[model samples]
Target: KISNEITQFTFPFDNDVWSIPVHRDNSYYESTYKKSPMSKTDTINTPATFETKDKLFVAIHEAALTDFASMTLLKAKGNQYKSDLVPWRDGVKVYAQTPFNTPWRTIIVGTKPGDLVTSTLMLNLNEPSKIEDTSWIEPSKYIGIWWGMHLETFTWGQGPKHGATTANTKRYIDFAAEHGLDGVLVEGWNVGWDGDWTADGSSFSFTKPYSDFDLDEITSYAKKKNVRLIGHHETAGAAKHYESQLEEAFKLYNSKGVNAVKTGYVNKYLDKKEWHDGQYGVRHYRKVVETAAKYKIMIDNHEPVKGTGLQRTYPNLMTQEGARGQEYNAWSNDGGNTPEYLNTILFTRMLAGPLDYTPGNFGFDYKLPQGAKVQTTLAAQLALYVVLFSPLQMASDLPENYVGKPEFKFIKEVPCIWADTKPLDSKIGGYNTIARKDWNSENWYLGAITNDEARD
Candidate 1:
């Protein structure tokens, strides 16, 4: 039964409303028709004015009230689920995958009741309201380098030619300091590993050095060069125990001057109750945030909680790898970094919040051509710095690939975080164009990419 309890609003853009409607199933989209309130009388009364859509997590509007006449039919709100509306905006939007005792408020757009519009919707079960914070980690001045396990997996003591080796790692550190990168990230630094690829081997070292690679020396050396060392804690197959040791780990590492840590629980996909953890995969995540905040050390999550836009509450939650990332190079026979895949992410995964899916691969083709493998063209990689939003952005490619490449100038120009983010245009699974402004500068950065055919 369709309930008559209606939520109405006008549009909020200068152009026709280009909105992504949120449904009870947690799905969202870019509506084909402009959405707006309809009167019992269909008369062109006034000039085009703005409207707003106030929902828990989204708010947007349509300024040019052009094709909305056909989209007036809305699904009935019932005890089963509630509907949601969001208007497109050019700024950061917050989402929460699980409930917490933090303050999150909804953004109301448009001036009048009939002027509001909604773009996306979700199942709000004790759902916390979405609110904006005046304080956000501005990413304009910082550049980040991320070195993780998969690449480390390829090194195999064969030197830099294979992948990430000790010599290559040092070169990366030097390159960051020399080329003006503000921070460096090293994942897979935690203990427990088998020599030949045991999934969860017991023979690992947390405090000991790895085959002559000293953690203390790396941290100290990076510090001497004025570069920040980003730490990683890979609790392989151990989520419950990871939290118990948080304080001890933080104290020990912070004493060594490590300011940030990328904690991971990639075991979710593994078939085990211990691996599933609990509640939207955020029960343990909240604990980590609380503990990390107590220590005054920031965090970047990998294979952590799916961003329900919690960065608003816990600013230290930098970025996450919830989707298939660059590591697909090693596993997938044919890398699946397709244009459609990229397009699907914006409408799906990114709607939740910032992703640490590191972009920028200098080479492409590992097996067939035997060269460094990259997913897209260099320009597409460059555009990712603009399109894919994250607070701590990464230049994941090897230093040697970028040593003589002049195109890195563009990569260097991309801002990590922005004061405003505009979903300029989108075709859901086809293509999307986005524009972002530096948090401090007046300049704007735009990134646009297409799916297979490029029709959208």
Candidate 2:
């Protein structure tokens, strides 16, 4: 280890791929599908953490200037793996002035998985809430026009089958209102859905809705039903485009009483220059949270940087999608994620913060055209509402699939925010159960899930 920390360096090469050596740590977990929405290559492009075999995941979290990302990086250093902070990604250099205290290097430990599951080390490390008037930052359950696009039952692009049309959005709003859900999310209402938007989102528009969808009318109607219109801003990979329209977009939503938004960074950033969680990516995400705060908007960011307990500083940053989410069950390599997948991540990636795993899917028996299927049982689907922690949760299935099903009641009744969490029997990849006290009511909810084996 070096005695002096160098604030400036004289590397002759460009800042392409660089990381600062933080201290060294032993223990590496065997992870095949570390990144979520599991595909053949989500890892080569996604940020990863140090997963160890000791039934615990340890990481360094930034206390301030969170725009810098830290990692328990896994590199073949001689015979053992060491720790590092992925400071520079591709083009950006992490050069800061001196007198800067390094982020907190933390090691979260537990005898049983429960100890790791319920530990508040991440939240305890972060500063207190920056949003004083946090009444508007609601913990909600929403129904969205999302699964259809993934399921190939509907289209994100404008067409006869466009999922975000005015009619389709109204249908969801009505469903949410009738079911007592707090919000409705309608994606693909904007102008960027056509022709390779994810490859380069320079043409995406945040403020403008497609001609078939009515943002003002939809927002107004949702208000009448006492439901909020959860907004979406998918940048594909064009950060600058989204930044340019950030204020204009926030202004429109604010005027219409849209208090929450789900952002996407499904990017091919700057000819694949910046990483989604690099220093540049970190700064952009932080700006979104700060800017969203001014307009009293809560955010659920996807393809996001790992949560560093920043929600304490910006309560408006509600939750994040950084794990292999439910979508992997519908389409992934090896004919869908293994049954052990969910339990595995619950101990590892979930240690960071609240995750939007979008758990309540009733279509446990459906198969895609290519023969992939959801690996969870119906009971497990219900159990996820209690296990996964997301302030802005989603009942991630079509309304038709949910109606009249007896088990759907659990999704409706589950609480989004919790006052307390109690872990029960658990193994990292076998089975897990947890009970949580509701943030509002005195009601307590318990959720348990297992691997493919039937639990007695």
Candidate 3:
């Protein structure tokens, strides 16, 4: 049951629907009322959103964050949009005792569409902070060898062009020190990235480094340079194997003064059978977060379960990527994300919590290996730093790409975390403008974006 006060605010897909297009993401426009998405048995994934004439309805799962990644499917039926909450979609036998609890199936009612950007309902529903001392949970901007790997200028595995190496990492650390960046992220520094890292991550070692990366020396060098070393733990969706190494692995990074980790689960399923968004995967992800907290380590999760304000409870659970973000524009199967993608999520998935979108790739002129091309303009890349919210923002281009460029200046000046934020104006999947005040300074930054056809 919903609060009586919000009952009038409820306007589902009835005849009140407009001729507007519905978005699953920016690229999703096939299912507008013009041709009814309800014609088929299409089930929308959890933590999704839909736009009405004047309201924003957020279909979220597990509002009170728990150890259950239940899938909440939204659909338009019976002249109104309805939601069906299920425990697991993978057809697994869920064996739970009667005394056990269930996940919270919920929907956030926005008085207006802008509430998706402003309301913290999901975070508010969660418990208070678990970490009493949050002084170490600080936010900052970073650069990495990541983009080059995506562009194929460098490889993840070792060779002449391997992105993660002792010299390459030190240069990135030096760059972070020179600029105002607080940390450097180095992926593929560990072994097991060679040969099909995604198919089977059983060989990945959390405590050991490749012969060329030199973890001890690099971490020590970063410490001397007044920069932190953000660690990378790419599981390739091998959840069980990674789970076995969690305690010892995090303990290793903690000892090295590495306080933050970017964990990846880049597979369709966990352990070749477990759904990454099911109860089994849910327990594993939470275990990683709580385990990292014991070592004073923060987490940035990619290929993640939909965030539900758990960061408010565990401030160390900083950011995650559950949407099809900037990287898709770099290289994906279907060209790249459409121009309207970022603007779309601003009012949809973003309602859940912080997202590590890894923005600011100013490589407009650079040639991609495939016929792939960046779909957005150079200006939007700059605007993303402000429009997209994340405490741990990434300058996700090669170090060389930013050299001596005018747009790079805005990226350098933007703050990752905000003291306050306000959405000035927005049209779902069309355009958006937002202003944010830096948490540590008096300065405020404003950003605006439009769909691909917004301007010439």
Candidate 4:
């Protein structure tokens, strides 16, 4: 049974004021430390650390628990203290019996934040790769029909200008083949778009295609161009429905020679009950990865659960859009992501796993439908191809937009996977510089970006 006793633990330091990181939803901005109320389900298992000016830091690592685990920072008046942050006092209580092996409570001591960034502690904690035969898994540069839909230039559904029609897809395939890109992503080719899939969740049918899109024709055309067709399954946050269709959907893709799939969970739960990082959502994601691997299909998850070093075990989990991604620039009303955004994520969210940020956008001055603008320069956008590490990278802008642009050459030449990475410089939310050696070729690439000010 779970107990609610106020347990007081003492550390070596005696400072009254302390900084603590409260565990919240992974998508939310959580930087400051405050003594506030929080639910047990919302709490993070990772510990809040204490750092000294001399570059010494101490962090408490909690053991993983199957049941909901929550914590609140408590400051002692003398040698003892009481717990008052109890938002989940009446909520679900987790229970465990004896002989249950709890996760390790590790205390990691590091010289600086960068030391932790370079540490292999998380990787060491995970088991080795389960897939012995990884020859089919190759890093790739891809182009897709996603950006135009986000920009409202075309609709996801059938219309005069549908983005995923057979003709439009062939255009993307031609571009990919000419530019030496490995894959093409065609979204909204299915019959579910006309319904309210985001709210109702029963509107999508994965196996069925729209009347305008001939799957066989597009697949054959893509094959002739020597470009792999990356499958798209936008669940619209309907995990339960997607789960039922996994086997058939994967089989269809496998038969069509489609090797990779980009799965999107863009909305909340259909039942309106659970958060994406909760246990239910976590299990659903794992199920997709495991089932996809059975069909030799790699997965790139969008609006996914936070990466917790699962890629080590499941290699088919290529990359995920777990943070604020490039689509924000196309539709966000807040004037898109700041220059410091990616620099901060380099150490924070990226430390968990590879991210599908979809970096290549040449139109720096292009205004979105929401009146927001991309805040970075053309040079900064080029830098992201090297800075953001994803096995599956996308030349996100349209082919027409890239015409006659010299920077487009870098997108074509930049390697998606790296042999080794060196962080030349990193300051949280300020500036970051990184160098990476290409995995196959001996070429090296460097990417650097500053906050809002120009850096020399």
Give Cα distance to truth, residue 372, candidate 2, Å.
2.0
Superior candidate under TM-score, 2 versus 4: 2
Q: Model 3: runs farther than 4 Å from truth?
A: 1-12, 15-41, 53-62, 74-77, 80-94
Q: Write the residue-wise lDDT of candidate 2 on 1-456 in tens digits.
A: 112222221122221221122221101111233432111211121122233444343332333437454444333323223333444543334545665545555555456667766767777877798888888877999999999988888888988889999888999999999999999998899998998776778888898899999888888899999999999998886777789889989988999999999998775342256655556777888899999999999999887777778898999999998766777666665566566777766766676688898878787667676666777888888888888888889999999999899888888888888999998887656788899999999999998888888888
Tens digit per residue, CA lDDT, model 1, 116-225:
11122211212342223324233422333333334443432223333223444565678888878866765434445334323442333344434535677777887888
Which candidate would rank higher by TM-score, 1 or 3? 3
Clash pairs, model 2 backbone: 29-51, 36-324
Q: Which tens-of-lDDT digit does each residue in 1-456 have in candidate 4? A: 554435544444442222323434232222322222222122322344445444565444332322333334444454323332223223433345676543334455666545545555655666678888888787889999998888788788888878988888999999999989999998999888874556755688898999889999999999999999999998878888889999999999999999999998767442355555544565678889989989999999998765656687778999997677888887776767778776666665565568899998887666666876677888888899988889999999888999899879999999899888887776656788889999898889999888897777
Regions more than 4 Å wrong, model 2: 1-65, 76-80, 87-93, 268-271
Each model's C-alpha lDDT? 0.50, 0.72, 0.74, 0.72
Residue 275 lDDT, candidate 2, scale 0-100: 55
Q: Which ten residues in a row have the lowest lDDT in candidate 4?
A: 33-42
TM per candidate: 0.66, 0.86, 0.89, 0.84
Clashes (backbone N, CA, C under 3 Å), per candidate, total 40, 2, 0, 1
Model 4 off-target regions past 4 Å? Answer: 1-52, 56-113
Ranking by TM-score: 3, 2, 4, 1
Error of 3 at 203 (Å): 0.9
Candidate 1 minimal-lDDT segment of 10 residues: 62-71
Q: Which stretches of candidate 1 lie over 4 Å from their true place?
A: 1-168, 195-198, 201-207, 269-271, 275-277, 368-373, 454-456
lDDT by residue for model 3 over 197-290, one digit each (tens)? 8889998999889899899999999999999999999998888899899999999999999999999987777777666656676778888999
Cα misplacement distance, residue 99 of candidate 4 (Å): 7.0
**Best by the TM-score measure:** 3
